[model samples]
Target: MKRPPYLKTSIGIGVLFIILMFLQSWLEKQPEALTASSEPETQTEATAVQPSERLVEDKRVYEGHNGTNLEHVYITIFDQSAVPENDITFYDLNESYKQYSNLDSGPKLDILFQTGTAKGPSDNGFISFGTDKPNATIELRGRSSRLEAQKSYKIRLQDNGGLWYGQSVINLNKHADDRTRVRNMLAFDYFRRIPDLISLRTNFVQLHVKDLTDPSSEGKFKSYGLYTHVEQLNEEALAARGLNPDGHLYKAENFEFYRYPDQLNHQNDPNYDKKKFEQVLKINGNENHDELLQMLDDINDLSKPFDEVFDTYFQEDNYLTWLAVNILFGNYDTMSTNYYLYSPLNSKKWYFIPWDFDKALGRDAERTDGLPQWQQGIQRYWGTVLHRRYLRDPENAAALTAKIEELSAIITEKTTKELIDSYYPVVKQLALQEPDLSYLGIEASEFDPAYRKLEQVTSRYKEQYMKSLEVPMPIFLHYERKNGRDVFTWEASHDLQNDKLSYEFQLSKTPGFESLIMQIKEQPDFTYNMAALPAGRYYWRVLVHDDKGHEQIPFDYYRDNAGIVYWGVQQIVVPGGSSS
Candidate 1:
């Protein structure tokens, strides 16, 4: 067969895949960064042995700092390919830089770290290691913060004599949003806390990027700021979970059905063999994806009932729980691409692992319609067809809402609130780790995300944290023009636990209400006299407010400000008419 139709990938992605693999493998093998230069007693010594190579003691680990188990690993890269650092461009972050070579060997490395220290100087021993050749990629810009400078990074950590964690490859997520550096980490935390969910681990780290090859600043190093150490869901992860280590672990992209073996290539293999379809997954681990493909075929085959096929692969509760968590957290980013699917020998059963949750629990970014959500959809496969079948049914919809309510209870039982609050110091501490970060207002005191994050938790997440809460994110129901008047009505947003919220409404002539024609409070419906105004289209939306001007929540006694509890928007054409 010509590889399953469901697993569609680019016509030719092997070159890109090969380059990425080389970069990841080489990055992993390089030694971790050592202590800050200020800490002499905790210094990591580097000894040149042969061919500009040296042993770097990498003590990029810490036991307890910022109330989390994380390591401050430093990395320094040297371009030895005769091509100058200035010659490299930003495209190296994706497209292979002509100078990078996509080879795991060549560049000189110095990975060292101080022992028994999170920040301050220590008297303990140090460890180090080095690599002459490392596959590399540049850390590109605008993906996170404007203050950030271009840097280079790799996923693989070197085997430094049991000093570092067993996991090899990882993507260092530079806490980019600048709002809550821990947005992804917190989502991972919640996922791990939930029963039976497969969640990856993350920690904080400090980075140092410099040029040992550039004649201008060969020995000089610059701070790249703090980064979140995120573990990749690879074959190693499967082994740790007591599952078949040799099974397939597919990292989703564009929500496509990635069951074809032809779409991916193995990390070490350079030759693009069309016959070796089994190795097509980009994160393709252990060489077999047959089980996964079968499930996809079944899931997409409309001939069979959706329940029958869904049962063949996924556990209903897990699916529902994932849905509930995403909805509750407003993780609009929860698409197939941000998830990893694990399959054993036969595709009859699979496990779900959510990934890249930087968009979670940060704002009231909810969607009223569409798949993969407008905010999260990245022009890729939105999700499996089975997902639509489950949520599309009234019965299933009710069950999922109930599940969301149940999870909401657990979150409001002071768990999620505590989790969110306790992490404030950790995030703040991580941001404050490097003294140089503040000069650019990156982690400055005036730029803290604590208060705004609190507002999000209390306002956007208000209904979820409250007991037996209702008011389903107010939506625009109907609008009409009759009898020379414009009438607009919307679904009311109220809580069953306490009907103490009032409807705050605003209507404006423009899309963004720089000026408003009508501002009404405590009303779910409004009417405008068409005969009394100009003929044109107007925009409107509803905002919910508390009866007491502001409301105090149970968990942490968080008093929420006057905010839009629910959201809905619509436009109406006012047909002007003459009136007496």
Candidate 2:
């Protein structure tokens, strides 16, 4: 119906406004709409993007379709139909090569990799058109973890390479030792949020395996249980994370940053030994290690100013953050190994990147695995030369404490509890099921309590770190039999606060000190005299107490083959001919 001209004009304006609003909403959602096929293009295409941009992109790739508690499921199939019964299979290879030294040289089995949503054991929802062929090679990964029945695996994409989460090398860890199975993922998630830190992409993976090795068995997929996928640090990883591809990257095996002139030499040097060199720092990226050797040389040279050497070789922010995070988390395993060192091709400054964090978050404490008593706070890092030297300086030590306080604000009880709340349910659900249920490190009932303990562990560790700074450094104990009597002497403890210190000498029949055979309290000297014992084993320890009533144990420890570590105790054996 024809209306007045004024009314018609108002109606037209209203209609146009509605149309524009819809267009704006659609555009906002489509900032970068990625289809399944187009996802790889975004990751593969090299662009002049900032490190922050690359970090966001990498984070998105790892988060997957469901970023919450419900993780993604990765299904791997190994068609061993043609292989003989006695021939080495994936399981056999893992068993045969448990040592880290031989793992790289071990045989890898062919695998078909696929992605799916983690529903339940009944419904994995595996994509029917997942990677068409066997696109990857699977091998055993990890040192001690390889010993478990449910071993960690390293999957390397082959010629028919399809990037699973934009990664060519995917490390699926069983977390056999970690009961929660979420500690490593928890650390990675928090580390990603911290600035100046390069965090690896981590995701919880529910794995299903179909092995055609046994012909009599049904061709149905078996639930291998839950695993955490820690992105392998490699050339591809460095590029994906927006770091220089040609940079130096090494995994610290047994490295303490000491200058191993004989082993860690130039490839052309007469004393150059690849095997021995790798026993320290395993070369992961560029083969050239000239810069690394130089850094090590400077670290070992006491004549060189420590501050200058540290400033020249390390990015202070990265170093502090790395040390601070590890300290706060009580990750004692990182004193020597369980980390990666990286530096750009042009830049002389090296950075520390965290690796293998399953042992973090008071996991050892929770399990009562007999970790050394001294493996707490600043003392945890005392074993390493670099840390001992760097922390010896009051300024550097204070800087570390400041960094710890700054990071503590971000990684608080609230943030940690949130992660635990979300992850515990998911892990517990599967952890009670078949495969994972069998290999539970802790009792099924202990899950709730264990996670509860971790909720406030960071704060507790922070207190310990602060306390460690005030206390004296651990003393080195020496024992000898002099004139039919046992003589115990230790290096004098130097309290940072310059407080008067008193010594306590203890001799125990057992390492745990259930009963003490001899005890001396408030002794001014570090030496103790006692009658020689008959043929037997004994554990002796020394403790220092400062004027402020802060006590610290000696660094000496007694570690048995059963993974029990007792600190501040030295085991002495009196031979059959020893005087009584």
Candidate 3:
């Protein structure tokens, strides 16, 4: 067969194109070579600044990591030696359990940290540390998780050192209570995709640590197992996230929107104690707190309408989106704390940014039963003054519901299911290895069910959100000993329909209220008088009922060491010879 001239030329070009495509594919499949040196592989100014520029332009790729984006990090601890020329040895690094008691605010230890990159699925990561002695300080971090044998950590780059992926402080969360180990990361990842909400950067990290505190010990780095590296919320983080770094930022340590006259005064006030102020709201950026105090004052003043204050002092979309995300995720711990408040220098509006979501997505519910019975709805936020005022209005409540529905449509069950599926294989094998396995909250055999349960956790919370709109907000119960008698009092519940309300008060010896020592029902008054309780401990609760037959429990709850929450229960202890 004879071919024409043009046909022959076309055949030649086709063959060449296939060969080049095969060559490119082969090159792409190969692993990336290890960097020759560890001094951060010097880069031109432009190359170094491009990522940050891209961050300002495109937020989608900000701190974005895939399911398979598992990274390895090595940290080597060293003593505070004055001699800079001394050789590093196993004796330089030491471990002492006595110093680990206060992980919440303990002093940090100087450590040399290095990170590795794996370009492909089959690549084995490597670390390089050349002449960069110790550039950071590491401290045991977390509130309750500090009690766990395995601990989370806070790593801060010190001495004007280089940034770790454009961050000064890095929070590596172990999520000790969550067996799935990815609930916190999942929440942040999902929020990152939502436009209305401000999201932080997060990635999966595998940590290795070596302790040379003991002279006789070998200083080999041991696998600390898998951790989720959540970017610390600070001025640097805010700037990177496109926020006003020079604006006010405060982490709610124990703030409930109260105008604490004695504690939370301005820095210029004579009685203003920084320690006392920090106990309630930890100052993170822009120490000037006049705006925050003003907002708190407005929230505390019942004379001002909440909607007006909300419109004047808050971004409506930001507030609603934060509330809606927390509701759907079931992050009930945010009533007084576990969130950040920010206000730009030029604006009167305050914004809510979520933090510490480890307890969200039914992770707590899986460990505890009946925890969400009272904590599941808009009423769950009644403990906070701001939320109480906001939710008391029907319009704001409906607005929150609409926001929840909007987010629900975007982050559907299938969407979450795919996320869980993607994250499962990445941490499955690593979770079973070394330290993580020893501290595993659930059995190895239960990972499948745990993840499967997580897929439906958010949706279940959404259903609860809808049902919560049917009931009134839970009342705040008060107790005092008055003239030899025990008096129980609580605020009247706010019903949307303006229905007649009645109270049912029950006193019990056990927390579960299995047997009631005293039961008072169908009472119209908010106050109940009873004889002095015995010199032992007792439990009590008040249930609210409406004319249309809607019932709701109180906002109070009792939490045990196991994280089990008993809702609507309050405890009283009587001294043998004194009325209390």
Candidate 4:
């Protein structure tokens, strides 16, 4: 029965009271209240716009805002050489910047210095925030996530000392508006707290670009809006993490080790066409990555014991940790891409590094049936193979499940809700004041209420996530197609929470399931006579649902690449000759 309104109100009050008390207790224990600091440790500020000045000017101080305290970073980039020449600049910064979206080779751009504030010396004024080096070279970055309006960037800090955060390369992420901006930040933050994993450091930076050629300009930089600053994983990053700096570092764009040089994934050559491989991975220090290829060879080798293959080639904890985190965050997009693989030069063990999490926290805006979309399918070949091995060994499955349970507390409703409650007011206040917010589909006028609603919508995900019942995958028994009747059976799924479960079998003409031809409900197996069905190809899968109305991705779906993008789902062709 539904609780009465007064009782529900009382329960809500009790929850809020507890949260407020907890936050108060937690804050009392901390040396400082949670706040945004522009600088980490390097503390390089090249300009006069001091941190104190920006905080004071931008209204980020806790002084006036409603319980909001912030110190947002600002970057002023000037085209020093583009000095106006007879109403024409030597280089058109604005136009040249636009061409990069379409051009294979973007124009070279140089930065004289990067200026930003520090949490420590806000009073010291804005200093040149960059590597010990003086300046930088900037270019476009990203693969499928790239957009013309919101562009990601790669900054090569001059080798001498131009690194930001004491590194040579930096990735500036322009998370599209459709993506919750905090998704990437939250993932990185969570990874950092986990032991043994190499987590990327992230911060927000406000960028401004100027066009010197336009005589209409009073010398002032135009706001480029907000961006998430991520340190590029390179040799320097490895060194920082106490690993071999010269170790082979590969940031996956579309990596599938099993398909090397086979047309899709990059070729397994140390000398794989630099330009071609550049499209997929940043092949750092290992132009001849024979070790990576060997690892893949070992992975695909059926003769090798499954336990030995993973234990010898991969630091399983790192893989397991990365896998566990992604699964909880609902980032299925990461299995094939949005990750980094690195190996020490002397040691053959490879580690998985987390990357690209803007799609996390929730699957997407729509919580249809309260299930996160990110939890749907693992569509990468490497992931599928690993999962297949996991199935072959129950020990690995138990261990993985254990890891998920252990980490689940971190993503629990109470914890995430607490974070959302505390962070929203501060970050929302800061993001709203950002200039050029229009490009991100954020308008200056809508800052107050827009961010408020975003926080509300974003945090609702935790409710569903916390209530979600973690169900073991269904097992595929056997399939037989006799007389054009396809019969598939699967072991029933059991809910860890003891929630009742029902099965739904689906067959679609397309992998996207845009149009469903058949649905079988409350059954563990399916029998569909397709002889009379169309002669084209079809995809099939079974979804197990709980009494709570949560559904689990089929076992075969996890063991193989499936979906509209991957065609990994079970399949049958009419007038059948073969099926997967």
Candidate 5:
């Protein structure tokens, strides 16, 4: 009855095999348990690691009116939250502002705020302001982490305390036309009506306005306005064309109301008509005759009919007329510095263009002599004193006075007031068509204040014209080294009395010698040995003190005077020991 031993052994082996299969099935069902065991370890690895933080900063120069320069800038971020340990790097916006090391002096401003993540805290982040020049460092103890994520920081600059002049913003209300319509119309007109014009289409969008007017909406309204026909020259463009790179050529952007001066373009020419000079001289016999003639020559040479010049100074009268119109509006800021005379590429002719029309319409003064209210609005927004000094030269002053008399005859009191009345209705109609600007307190009724102010300023300008008629034209001279010798030059003049029959030279490149260089008592033309000059830039100016030790008022020729006038770089080696 007992089973064979082999059967018992086989039965035991089958039971063991069954148990093994059951274990395998249970393990397959426990996959969740295995994954749960590994989760904590993966998260722990991630939590223990931190991201690296790095920031890159850059600086550059931005140029403005009358050789005024600004530092343009940008920064790059590599990490989201980590703070940079080193000071940010800055680059010079222009070569003129570069230090000895060729580095920008950085903004010398300081920011003060409470420390916190919230919006209203001081010391929230390190804030800097002002120039980076020596003895101008303003630093604070604060973490850089407070800077907003994925945002840029921009700094605007001014020379003197914000008093002298600085960047400003202007917000133009949308025109009577809608955005799309304006864009299309401008494009069509640009192509069909004025093919030579360069056009940029801007919108009334908040962001575009913000970019132009930094520091937000609180900036002065003088910074923003609508100036339709402003002309501006591109100095860089003209330089590229091998034309007069000095920025004396016509540019379309110059037509902006804020850019052109309120005065006439041609002033203080030595070559001014003898009959006119005699009239002015008779009134102011003590006037510096020689200096006045030189200035007239320079002005005429620059503003003369472009066709008459030796292929370099030719400009169109239509462009000049546009400038004249802007000037008539009392936009008196343009001159040699801010305004430009430009010649197009592949063309020999040059033209004048208006620039920066923000101060037009005499906004700050009362209506007088029936000048249009809009034309009088400019007095409210005066330019820097430097502007007045440059624009009111004897020639420009005289010419402007004549033009104003002419304008007065044409733009009679009744007609000027009528123009104002017409402008009010049109502006009112436009306001009704557009509602967004109402929020900014701009309504048709407010136009009167702007208009009346312009009128008053225009009257003052007329007074200036009368006074200028009593003064003789001013004179000036500039000398540069050509062919390795100093060539004494004066502004082109027709008057024999204003010609540089002789001159004296005072040479000093360093700032210390400025006084000595200015002290040359007399001489028509003087030359210094080239061998005496060191291998570096040298500056020298001519003092055409006339027969007397007196020169024209320095302010009259600020743009032409007070800068490096010569160069003494290392000699270049040419083939066969001939150096050029």
Candidate 6:
């Protein structure tokens, strides 16, 4: 039978699944047999285990096979459920040990442990056993209505440190009805089904441990590694370059430099020579500065052709698709704090690379509040006010609006679903094969219900936003002649039935718009020309008023505010102009 394109792809995917299943069966069966056969001996010893004996038994030692000198000690979990005497299990470790769980109809199991240690080269010096390291501990918590229960689980080591650098998967537990068992089984199957798509990036492994000294502390007793985070240069990099602590051009050393706690102070007030650091940054590198500024200007220019590019490159519906995805995924830590920009030997252009993704996948607690304040205010503050005066004039707003609409279209349900479906097999394969990999968590299916809900809501908001953009007016011309005359023109239309369409124009040189050239009102299709203007870049826009004493609500205006409707602004260059 002839298969459709999508069907052919689906069938190919199914075949891959079969192969993975075969591989997983082979891999899991070996481990299952070993565990089952050893159960009797383990149970026999456990039966004879006394409180004092169990206390000693609770301490487990893990030694790296490689030359790496890493070691860890863990306290086993003590099952407290009211099960049969034979089914009961006990450990000397407290309940505060670490726990991990899977909530998507998969597995549930808690691993409790204490203390881990590592020495020699195997320790890699990159691993940390305390609470100071970020993501040192991984917790699996769930809110469930099926059993009317909300539970938090912890899994940790006896002693926190180990040096088996490279990738390793450790199965904490396997039981007939265990959620972790089920989840791992499914993940292994997925990986076996598509091995080619998976890759593992790290090898260090350590068990979670309870902070015996601080049991009640939040995020206490975690496992983590200490590795140098290679800084990335990207959009946030540009923001970093433009960041000024005092908001002044001088005093360049006032900027804060930080890596980890104890590396540097919150603000640099050291006795080091200010000129030395300034020379290192070379803030006066005019050519490099121009190139960086040009890149920013290009991004701004992209706003004008947004609709056309979105339609042709991203499909009309997918406008702002990438931006929306980033937001939905909780890439909210994009402010200047965690990212940096650098130039090697005065490069003409700067490039941006993503440095951190731990914040992605909506892992942070505060991320559930929906869109951030800064994003919501982009249109009002950036589009309406700042952009109007500095970035682009009102006439450019229409093009930008069209562009945003196109971007939104590109990220529509059909498109997003297609993207997810296409990547599902690959993501699942990676998750299964490299379950211990950091930064990249398991596939979409493993996410908590809250995470899924947040993603859906964010996507809907982006869609609605695209639909709400009003049509925009275009800036026609912005130029100043050598004669000290400044002229601004825009393509005008009088589609309204109201007569005597009055127009007004305003000019300002500064961003706050303190400097004014003139303010006048006339009919639609009006042009304003002024002479004796200073010779620097200027911003100007037009407004329309109805003669019938009725105010035309600024529907399409970049900033929806009363009074003076804005057309757009232009830069005027006068011959022999000087900054006043």
Q: Whose lDDT is greatest here?
A: 2
**Residue-wise lDDT of candidate 6 within 244-292, one digit each (tens)?**
1111111112222111122222123353343343432213222223333
Per-candidate count of clashing residue pairs (backbone under 3 Å) = 23, 0, 4, 16, 108, 59
Lowest lDDT sum, 10 consecutive residues, model 3, at 48-57
Q: For candidate 5, lDDT tens digit of each residue in 101-194? A: 2112232232111112212222212223311221112221111211212111222222221211112111122222221112221221221122
Ranked by TM-score from best down, the candidates are 3, 2, 4, 1, 5, 6
Candidate 2 ranges beyond 4 A from true positions: 1-86, 97-101, 117-133, 442-445, 478-492, 502-538, 560-564, 574-580
lDDT of 2 by residue, 1-580 (tens): 1112112247776676566667656855784532212232244424312221212224443444332344554444455544222255555666666444568777777666666555433222223334434656778888878777888888887655557666788898998878778888889888777866777777777787766554544756677888888888888777765456787889999887788776799877888888888888889988887888888889999999887888788767778889999988888789889999987676677888889888888776766656654577887776678988887766677778888989988999999988878787678888888888888866789878876887888998898787787887787899999999999999877666778888988888789999999888877777888888877888999888888988888888888668687878898988974333
Which 10 consecutive residues of model 4 have the lowest summed lDDT?
53-62
Residue 330, model 2: Cα distance from true site in angstroms: 1.8
Q: State each model's CA lDDT, in order.
A: 0.48, 0.74, 0.73, 0.53, 0.29, 0.31
TM-score pick, better of 3 and 6: 3
Off by over 4 Å in 4: 1-104, 116-134, 159-161, 178-180, 213-216, 256-271, 278-280, 366-383, 409-426, 434-580
Cα RMSD (angstroms) for every candidate in the order listed: 17.3, 13.9, 15.1, 13.2, 33.1, 22.2
lDDT of 1 by residue, 270-345 (tens): 6545334322233455455445556777766778887666666676656667666765665655545567765554
Query: What is the clash tally of candidate 4?
Result: 16
Structural similarity to truth (TM-score) of each candidate = 0.56, 0.79, 0.82, 0.62, 0.29, 0.28
Clashes of 2: 0
Give a tens-digit lDDT track for model 4, residues 42-156: 2122221221111101111112322122324333234344422223232443345545553347554554335443322222222344322225555566654454456666666
Q: lDDT value for candidate 3?
A: 0.73
Name the lDDT value of residue 301 in candidate 4. Answer: 80
Candidate 5 has a TM-score of 0.29
Cα error, candidate 5, residue 340 (Å): 4.7
TM-score of 4: 0.62
The deviation in Å at residue 307 for candidate 2 is 1.2
Error in Å for residue 186 of model 1: 1.2
